[model samples]
Target chain A: MINAVKREIPEFIEGYGKVKPFMGAYANIGDVVKTSVKIKSVKPNDKKVLPSIKDALLKCGIKDGMTISFHHHLRNGDYVLNMVLDEIAKLGIKNLTVAASSIFPCHAPLVEHIKNGVVTKIYANYMSGPVAEAVSKGLLKYPAIMHTHGGRARAIESGDLHIDIAFIAAPTCDTYGNINGVEGKSACGSLGYAIPDAMYAEKVVAITDNLVDYPACPIEISQEYVDYVVVVDEIGDPKGIVSGTTRITRDPIGLRIAKLAAQLIDEVGLLKDGFSFQTGAGGTSLAVAAFVKDIMKKKNIKGSFAAGGITGYIVDMFEEGLFKALFDVQCFDLKAVESYKNNKAHQGMSASMYGNPHNKGAVVNNLDVMILGATEVDIDFNVNVTTGSNGIIIGGSGGHSDTAAGAKLAIVVTQLTKARLPIIVDRVTTVTTPGETIDAVVTERGIAINPRRQDLLEKLKDSNLPIFTIEELKNMAEKLTGVPEKIEFEDRIVAVVEYRDGTVIDVVRQVR
Target chain B: MKIVRPAKAGTMESNDIYIMVYPNENGNEIQLDSIVLKQFGNQIKKVIMDTLNELEVENALVVAKDRGALDYTIKARVETAIKRACE
Candidate 1:
């Protein structure tokens, strides 16, 4: 018996890249393999009428230095992340690494955890709020690693991010750990971002307030990947799941920019039947959608589809029969989620299907018109969305480069000056979207057509629109707002920016 | 409003009027009309095609608060409004 026990210890260690043959053997093995041994597993605490999350987590063996992860499906509605972290802190865990898919303002409680030395590292696609402020202030000991959507998935599959435990906040989960976000009290649709984390985490835990019976149909994250199930009360507030500012703008300046963007598409002669479009959920972008909708209605034109992070405004366009379908990668609001689930035309898409440059025929490639926002645009048409006037990481290219390269008409709509800072400059602080892909820039001051598209210039000359060369626009912006001071940097690469086609576009380094 | 003429011919005629009327005090309601097209339908098409060739014009003046109109609403509004005003 002792010999058998001793032999099993070696085999278990061998499973984790200890031996050459074991490493090869492990590669073929699925992330979750069925084992006959009676290993201890966490179970739901059924004694209490309403189970305490604290007890549930303790059962899951969450200890110091364990890597715990959560998905950003709930966005601002996410209470599970903070609740879990609070419980973990109460239980006195230290040196933990929070490997969240993305961090939003709702996860600002994490700043306290970092201060308390409970969480030392963070790995996510995006980070904002107090955590970002803390990071900017050099509060955290370790530098955070921010990745793109596809990059995060690659990191997990390539074994770079070995999550010790993944706590998925499922809106609905079955006893055997089947989960879906479509039909739940806090249904924030499409578990696309959590798919990789659920599959690859060492120990998968599904926490749901709404527990359905066995065999939850349309399982987005399957029971096969999940190891433990914990049921709790009040996972998140559904109201916080959707943003309030998802409507078209009534402001004249924003409306003007929107009209110009639509006109640019019309001038480029892309406002025809079977065209495709992608626009942000921003007020200006939504206004552009409204204008495009007007044109389509007038011309009795129909488009092939609209694609990107789905919004209620786009869903409305789809429902109104302006577009044939909506290829949605992530639902930005509850209305979009409802549309994605009910409307056959609105379909959920994965990162690869939506924008991964490696995929075959991503939806971005077929876009005819794409309206994107920018932090700053240079005379060369290069765009910067990652840094602000003071050269700090404010935003990242969520899908800016992907659509810019794929769309037939890539129109960047931005105000000439933001907070008295010139948006059109000699050189952008960081190049998120290269100039080669950006076709036109629409500012409140004037429309600057990239010289690369002289055809568009010629076509618009007879038109009375105020068209100016990029240099003229740049000078006008500088004249209005004094040229911004250049940012100095010491080279220590913090993050690598990947183009939609999976090539390295540029690298962002830590500021010294 | 004063009238501004195009520099070149075969372009939207300097006098080829395009009108926009918006009903709201803030120019919220927008309408478009062109007199050249009113007299000659095909001529408006020719001018549009020719002018588009010379320059890509995506400009319009918006007059808000039209009680209601059917098809040809924006075009009629543009033509008449341009004939009435300079811009």
Candidate 2:
């Protein structure tokens, strides 16, 4: 029984606060179970078609004040969340709680539902755009509960968040509910974010635009967990799955930054065979991959694997035999989705399996190098990707700190300045990734090795790349462009920035 | 494509500056009085000069009201302005 809870046992035991079991209570458990009446499984009738979403909700016993869940695999393209909530609103459901993986700008429709008293509570890994703006304004009746990607998984598994119905937007699903993200027209890549939701929800509904024959290949979410299958005209738009401009930087400054990052990795002796690397699909980070690819080709060395949100460029490297395998938590583009469908070596990984620190051996633990982006990097190497200079919540730490903390070498690639604002500051607006995890900071001007990494500093001493202390880099930037004016922020905290390990790193405030 | 003539210019000095405005095809124009443009002059000059240097062009004055123009879009407008100046 304790093993079922696993990592959560300690918390549960703490919450119990000295409830001691009787001495003979444990001994009689087996005999008591044997004397109890046995119940057989009653499968649903085969001839009945799954009802409409509204009818399905009624059948699933959905009522006011119940919590419903949605996955964010479709990201900005997702239409299911709003559509379902619209139906729920029409039904006059009030005080309902929405537990979604993450909420994007496209989820602005939800603000109306919140205003109409349909949704009173919300829980998500991240929130941005108008939804965030609405939350900041304190429009909702309840304060939104924010969790990290790993934290959400832990919460669901521990039964802390008991979801009544999980509305999973499957890119592809069979009538029997064997679903995968790789097959359908709306293939957005791996159905990683939905795995935990489906497993823990009392009733799981698989909504898909594409209904395949009998059994879908590569069952990401199995039929055993799914209770209902509903086919719709469209689940999501594939184009919105991958943002435009996931290309290498053509700008000289951005290229220089990428080159510096790649050289720093090589200088640290991490470019040899059997190495593993992970980089975000950002432009500068993709440029780093391009440079690393060239160096690997020139040296004729192959990597063990490349992990994280897989892009077509990484898929191309896999096809070129540069890496042994690609461990993809999510697919970021059409090519990656296609490769995920056909390629035997490409494997999908769940969020828990990818970055959960409590896990025995997550994929991030084996990463040799990880290139990340930052909105602001302090002299201490603490990186902030969550807020802008004005303390406005512009972005969220989506695996930035997770990969940085787990990887052997974490390199932060950023331009020295953006839109006349210096990115290297005395203190970051928010600390998403702590300084201890970050090894080096690469900028268009120069590279800065963290003082803690004496080994890396010694190794790169003779390298051609210009290396400077972080303070020195800041001073140089100030010399080139006069000291930037500090932004004034209001007293009210807009949002709390959460570290991947579920700690509150910092809070963002509205710009004054 | 309404191309307004460059404002009658004085010598390019610290104080004297030429402002060229090009309205979009939709005829959407953002008004910028001399005072507002002067406030943003230094930063705008740096950005335009840096882009011109990067693109290897010279002798252009660009005034743009970006509704939602990207970085590359800004560069293209500057380049077109430079070509017009040369002609």
Candidate 3:
């Protein structure tokens, strides 16, 4: 089967079971059934507290070949994934599949477990570090599964992916398993990624450093979903969980790209009242927010909302009355965490509500503009944020394609060439976000509007910025760097890159 | 021309290169290390040697630590180090 992006897909992957080719941006839709269910009978006197992770594993009836789940709100500072996996490895548990929301550098130890056969399969939204490298080298027996934030939720809800137990890393939790992300030393702002796991997992164990009195304040994951609570020494490092401040780009080229992106938004007339925006936490994307802030302030345009992983810059904009509200699925920095904790306008949204296409309505669907980053953008406008020029998996489409599919304008802001390699290529190594959804590409050299967006081209025609066709940009980049040699890869699929609609967009082969 | 003094340039940040140039009597030798060596090592090393050849530096010890910096950035940082070495 071939997906919308023209990537071939087998009917079945060894570990992942079935492959679904993306029909279209909105063509894939069906009735989503909630498959996870647990026996409700319980004793009133039953103590939900567990002595340690081992005890929690014992109590949860964790066994070989069962699918265990985790959330990555802790980002790189997470202690829960390693701690839990270490206990499982110690217990000699084998063939356990891990369904984590995202995998980070701190979870690199899982590479050893994968080698040891303690863990066999991985399902994640995003992944980086040593494990990703190992997977790219074909270390795992089966290719890993990558899903979008919303796609993962949809898969879990639709019974495509089932978890036997879910280990949730909570900042604060009560005796009865009421949890919130804003009360403890490791406060991470929002447990949005963990909410669906808690609600749908057959058994949920709330792992926390701060075990407070019953009824944890502002419960993000209510007691109804939680089955057990385990107290750990530390859930995560707060400093690592959220950076103290996520500043804008200092690089002149990055600033220029951001300036053009902001100007494009203003020219498109989406900078007026009730406009909603979403961007990444990258330096350049944050700089776009800063540049857009000046425009909003100058024009007195109060936007309807700001969405995705909330940053301090967006929080500041919201506080200054630039936006009416903030819909945050996760907090990327300390200021965002603080704002989510105190401000009424700063609301936490579940992954489903954030961008689940299967859901009734997503915040991204209401988004006016989204600023995104890319490792490569092809002549077709297909963006690759998943792999490097060397074809190694460095990132995944967390919300990259989701918001692109939803937003009125999806602008990919990146340098023309990164590390001597042309970013505007004839074909991207992997297609994470299809070009059909992307409206434009903003680089330091020039801005290239997608040929499909005639409306946008007409509006930006009078603008003073250098506007070129994507092919011209590609030529210009090639002329500067000369054409790069083709990267060679072995004939083994290391990982399958899934589109936002849960289809195979590309497959990363073994990098020799 | 020989480098009169030891000079260093660039940063340790990802996608950036850090270089140190020292006056060496042995010969012009470039020592390079990089994270993306398996993928872009050849290109990175070529950029370093090209910059050195362009500048006509014949007696310097060039040690470069790369974090996946591109050719243009490497050239700029190398040029900066050479100018600093002469200063």
lDDT of 3 by residue, A1-512 (tens): 77777777777777666777777677776665557467454588878888999998998888999999999889999999999999999998999999998999889999999999998888888899998898988888788888888878877776677888999999999999999988899999888888778878889999999999998888899888888899989988776798999889899999999999999899988999998999999999999999999999999898999999999999999999999899988999989999999999899999888888777887889999999999999988999988888888898989888899999999999999776578999999988888999999999999999999999988887889889999999999887766777889987888877776677777788888
Which digits, one per residue and each the tens of the lDDT, describe model 2 over residues B40-64? 4344455556655665543334554
Give DockQ for candidates 1 onward, in order: 0.01, 0.05, 0.26
Error of 1 at A363 (Å): 2.3
- lDDT of the structure predicted as candidate 3: 0.88
- Give the clash count for each candidate: 34, 0, 2
Query: lDDT by residue for model 2 over A1-512, one digit each (tens)?
Result: 12110111121122112212211101211211101211222366652137577877876788999999998888888889988888888888899989988888989999999888898888777778888777666566665655666556655765656788999998889888888988777888788878888877888888889988878878999987877888888887666666543577788888889988888888789999998999988888998999999999999999999999898999988999899999987888888888888888998888777776655557888999999898888887888776666555556666776788789999999888665456788877766667878899999888998898999989987888889899988887565545655656665544544455443455555556
Docking class of 2: incorrect
TM-score of chain B of 1: 0.28
The positional error of residue A120 in candidate 2, measured at the CA in angstroms, is 3.6
Ranking by TM-score: 3, 2, 1
Highest lDDT, which number?
A: 3
Cα error, candidate 3, residue A468 (Å): 0.7
Q: Please report, in order, the local distance difference test score of every candidate based on alpha carbons.
A: 0.68, 0.72, 0.88
Q: What is the lDDT ranking, best to worst?
A: 3, 2, 1
